[model samples]
Target: MNLLSAGLVAAVVVLIALSAVAIIRADRPGGAWGRRLRSRLLLGVPWGTIVSVLFVLAVYLFVQRGYWHWTDPVTIPFRSWSYLYPTGWLTSGFAHAGPGHLRGNLQATIVLAPIVEYAWGHLPQERGSQSFASWRTNPWLRAFVLFPAAVLGVGLLTSLFALGPVIGFSGVVFAFAGFALVHYPVATIVALLVSSVISTVVSSLVDPIVTATVSASPPSAPSWAGIAIQGHALGLFLGLVLGLAVLYRREGRPSAARVWLAALVFAVVQGLWAVYWFRGGGTYVLYRGVGVALVLLLALLVTLAAVASERPLISGERSLIDPLSPLQTALSLALIVGLALVAYLGLGPPFVGSASVAVVITVALRILYTVVVRIAGSGRWAFGGITRRHVAITAVLLGVALLAGPAVVPNLVTVGDDAVPEGETVTVEDYTIAYGEEVPNRMVSAIDISAFGETTQINTSGVIVINEDRHIWARQVSPQQLAYSGAVRLRLGGVGWSESVVVRREGWTAVGNGTAYQVWLDAEDTPTQHAFDSAPQTATPSIDGRTVTVVPDDGEFYLGVERGNESLGRTALPEVGETESVGRLLFSTERRDGRAVVVAERGGTSVAVARHEQYR
Candidate 1:
């Protein structure tokens, strides 16, 4: 290493060592910090959290083949696309899109999951329970087996019930936050900040220094545009349910106000409040106000569900709770979700349809309340043995239903129709890669859904890949993405196999008109295919009563001189600083005003015709 770099590394090592020594001294024998840690943790370490993070990292490096292709990995087959695709459902939760995605999730998991594991504890937490009394209460079993097993189960559940084509460990990360928030509400928020700091530190260590200059960057949607809101909410609700049950069993409670504030802050900062809808053709509409209000509602509902009193909402003389109450709550939750799914499929705009479903649920709940009051008036069973806690729990379940129910309709759909657009395509076994403009998106059109005058059948432009067998229909590269990057390579694989498809676009922009371009696709074991072509573009410049046009055909570009559809002549476009003649028009490429342009002249009068399109 260089002398300066070596010195920096040594300095960092010394600082870390000093910090460790200080911590050890402060936590010496009988120290308050040591005793406090022991109360909630084994050896002041969260072993379950450590193992869980390692497990997720292993999946990324090996299963996703990210070790070889750190930034680009085979992700098409790993997405939770449809119920028929069991491989996706089984693996999608652990798989990630790329290294940055994996790193962000792992950082959050490492920082926040420890709090949850600590709250769970290696020691038995239930009242009157002793450590090592049984397999359930064994410290080793809980830390190494039960905790990891539950994480895996929850990961699978998130994938099974998540919305269309979701991949990443973020849903599980949100679950960790939810569970931690219940026990240490304020501490969970603090951990969020700490996780950000850890991410920054890791990034600094990786890069050390950076250089930047003012330049145009690739066009991209908002970062929150693509978040899987449904999956995240489902995970959060699942965690909250589990956390509340554990808290009740252990006879421990945290402040409701703290829980509410923590939930709200976490939701807002983490972008759970970014409610959005796809507008197709590479666009989206974010409902910022609505999302913020929903965050408020979620916090309130979670607070109530976790801390509401155990007293019966209706005064009762009966000493025993109704045996059917639990069953009724479960059935109601299931029924509401079913109705919401049906409504989503039949109604307009998903958000509007979900709102209508909410109205139906409210009416149904009111009717149930009326029936309970009438039955209680008869005094057969007092208040049907329903407590405030039961009602609060039901409200929480309903919120979960509202969050996850509509996702079912989209997940049930498959690309049963022709997915490949009619054009030149390169086929690699079951996969077909093609490029087209203004073609209907098969993923969105698989089912007819419309909202805000925008239908799911909106047309998209760019590279598309399809695999009917795996229920895969994806726009791998968008028009803006390809236009900005000039080319892209994507990998498609399943299990232990993988193949690559390369897409390239070349275009020349008219001086004042649109660009003419051609797209090509190449796949393993297949010849390079001319995937798409656009019509000739005419430059808005008249030189000596003649106009120049750029015509792209069969992977070649031509310069044509025409006057009102009467072509004077056509010739191959010349290289930069080269000159070519077309009939009476002289065409020469030159650099003009920081732009490469083609100049057409005849007899001293010259005009700029077309400019070469540039991409970063």
Candidate 2:
């Protein structure tokens, strides 16, 4: 047997021996063996967490068809494209992008969710609370039903409010971490380490043996660049809200300092500080400084909100109905305005300054009128004259609102203008897929906003998909992405049906010049159509007063000899290691220097003209 196999076997034997030893040691009376299994489960096994994980897995395997095609699942229809697409809004949080995405989220969920569930507990912790006496206090009901139902509800909220067409259960996973962090900060961090170990084990099991070799890799963006920061923040706030409510009800407060430290570490490590925005044309900009500062502030605010005492901000003997002095009222108003401005501006560039001002004015006026009435008449003050806890909660909620409110403006938009580029397109149901270069990205441009040297009028090149009904005008595959990968398959569907559209790009790169390529769209039950053809590109090499050119015409590439726009002769490009003569120049293709090169020769003098790069 191989060395790895032998080691694995030995490890298994050692693990079995250790298990036997522990069981033997616990066999004595009053030992662990004497206790019921349920007693060790902290009220019961984490059935709710298990059920939640299973539900997400089932959606990926069955609903998204990851069962048949484990890596490439039907994803477009399941994304939260817009409010107009109810199916997408409902299923997006449950559906994942790919197998890797599903695995990563599930790994975190398996570790953190149990902690949150344990904190929730099967039986109520309230004074004199008895299990099974009431439905609210029933252990089985909480473990099997209530917890899972709450998770489902949170999933729906995340999907409905998340910006853009996001697909994944990652937001819910973050929620689990947030809630667990609030309850047991140190344990939550340890759970993160455990999660890493589990991930390593899974990876090792998936590939028991390893082989390494040098190879070219496809182009890819930074890992943190694609994170849905707004959605993640939204989920974290939601969890904090729920956790705080439970904490207050149970009168259990964790160490604020530990919570702050844990929150900071978790947020930074998990890329919650990776605040970024798309710059169109397959580019993204990250505001690292801004993101770090925001996360630090977020940690402090969360700590205060979760653990601060209910001491009134204002001192002295005063009833709830007592009128505040003009100075006090003025200071509160200024504080509100200051927070509003900071929060609003921090959520990007404020797409509509006038609208933002209007919102601030309207909200201020409503609150001002309410406060004036309460001061002039008799009623309980808001949150008992506003304690430190109330203020902290208000700040956190305001931050969440500012972060999430901007998403609504973008989500409310549809493809009202002509987003379909001027090119051959394949239509499936209400969707239109095409390939175009330098096409304006209507999605970003619709806001007509610019900031940090980035403008909304940016252009993009790639495979574009437009669904006016669903309010989707996305550049699915960028030019660089497609060039490196060579092909991409997209799935578009509605409630009960799905169809695939395969995009394949074939090109020949001219030496010292751009690529001459043709893009084809192959849809289900439809004949393959040539979608796009790039301009003819001339090679830098010259032979006998003629220049060899790679020309893409009518879905085929041809080798042409040209002399300053004057075509001497043209013929189909030669196969690899084969020759084709155009006029006095003989062109042949062969692999050299890890690239496919086309050489033009005359009188035994040859020069490499066009080349195609090979990637793994």
Candidate 3:
């Protein structure tokens, strides 16, 4: 929602309101085709808005040479035909026109224009001839086509996945609206008439489930390779059942079997969906069972709504299962709100005053401990001294647990891209996400400490991942902290700041021109100690590509412009007869006006840098 789009929406609202007044009051000439096409939407301002956004999006893509893309489409390097041997098939899809082009795809289900004709099937030329009560007719032709078109519009299918480039509104827009085909108790009107508050609340609670499923696996199975499987699959299932039911009802034939078949098909599709998701290294915990329940619920609702509309819609008209009633819902919400308030305020650990998942895990651990104790008491396995054996085993297990416990604590952790559904669009404390796109908003940031001390040099360079918004930002070169086991973490809170945090490890480098570098490390070598700057802790800087001993045994020191670059000549100290002369003379600098600046010192020796800049 930028400035231009906001203006467009406002304009549309005004125009649609005016149009609605015209159709009812002003003399309008629509008696046949024009009246039918108008439906209810045409008599409002939103329709005008739809027209504006569609027009802008179209203009942005086909013309203006990629209005919002990071670069021109033609300039995207990997997409060129010549690059294919080195690059794989994903080169095209991964290349986006710009943030706006990508953002449109993310908003697909919420609002994408309809297609001229849906890919799944057709709408009858005649209307009211299609009452949504019967099931044999095809209901989804418009919705199906619109979704793929929307997906393709953003290049999700065509450029990235193998099966498409079926991008655009044809799939998602239809898919979102397509839900009504199965749930056509005229949910919009009914929901509004009942209460906007309930509808809004229900939508909020359930939209995540819906978004999660469609994002996990879309319906166009062959095309969704390497994408979230469950989301797409559910979207496809929802669209299909809804569309078919509407088609059937309008054609005047409805069958219960058709609705049941929709569920069965969803189950079968889900099996394949799971296999693909797991094969691609996704967590089974994240995307299972949700899709099945959604399809069944949707299919039943579509059927019930079609049946209920003609008569007074009654609660007993369709059976409600053992459900968590409104009271329970309110109570549960209250409990969660309380917990969230405590956690967000940092009042205590998140599980404080709650019997949460943490409590469950703790109880399970306790149970396991009791079982183990009972077994140990029997002394069945160990022959001579069961007590001693148990003690030893317990000690070893405790030691291992203590050593590995940190792994379980996600106070800070890395989330692999495949670990969570991309659709969840998980947010970290430091950065914001572009909704469903899953593209990182911020990549790199760091800290600086050179201003603190004299003769304290902090030379650091390494790749570091840092939080941009939070204080967790990383820098290859900066003051940092180190863990010394000798100290207590609880007593100190955490390792306080030290000097020279290694942003990049020796082998791998940070990413940027002169900022990021590649670190080349062997598969199984240990990380080197990160250097720390201190009270002028004299250490050798490289000299002539060789490490110079900071203080030679003979009490001598060397000086050079840089440690490794040989172009700078070195001033070697003559062999000292005693330990009195081990340090080097210091150097200072001066501006052209003869004003002293950047003072430096070593061994009580100081020199002014009055030399020209060209001298270096």
Q: Judging by TM-score against the true structure, name the best candidate.
A: 1
Local distance difference test, each candidate: 0.79, 0.78, 0.30
On residues 1-616, what C-alpha lDDT tens digit does candidate 3 reach at each position? Answer: 5566556556656766787898856655466534544442223123322443454354334332344332333112222121122221223333333544444343442232222122122333344545234442333322333333444443332222222111222233333433433433233223223343434433433332232333322122243343433233333433433343334334342344553444344334334233222211122223336545555654454444333222212235442323334344334334543344334223323234223423332333234333443433432221122233233323322222221121122112222232211221212232211111122212110111121121111222222223222222122111111111111110000112111212221110111111111111111123422222111112223212332222111222232333343323334432222111212334333343542222224545343211111100
The better-scoring model by TM-score among 2 and 3 is: 2
Winner by lDDT = 1
Evaluate model 1: give its TM-score: 0.89
> By TM-score, how accurate is candidate 2?
0.86
Q: Score residue 300 of candidate 3 by CA lDDT.
A: 51
lDDT of 2 at 170: 84
Ranking by TM-score: 1, 2, 3
What would the C-alpha RMSD of candidate 2 be, to one decimal place? 5.2
Minimal lDDT window, size 10, model 1: 374-383
- Cα displacement (angstroms), candidate 3, residue 5, comes to 35
**Where does candidate 1 clash, by residue pair?**
none
lDDT of 2 by residue, 1-616 (tens): 5888668756766876897788777785355533443542334478998999999999988888887778888888788877777888899998998988899899999999888887877867666778888997888888889999989988997887688889899889888887887789999899889889877777665655778899766677788887888899888877876676566556668999999999999999888899887776567788999999999998988888778666777776874645556455545545564456545544445535525543554464436434433432325344446666656655655565565555665665566577888868898888899999998787767766554666657788889999887778888887787888888889777555567899999899898898999899989888888899899999887887889889998788899898877889899998888999987888888988667788899998999988874433
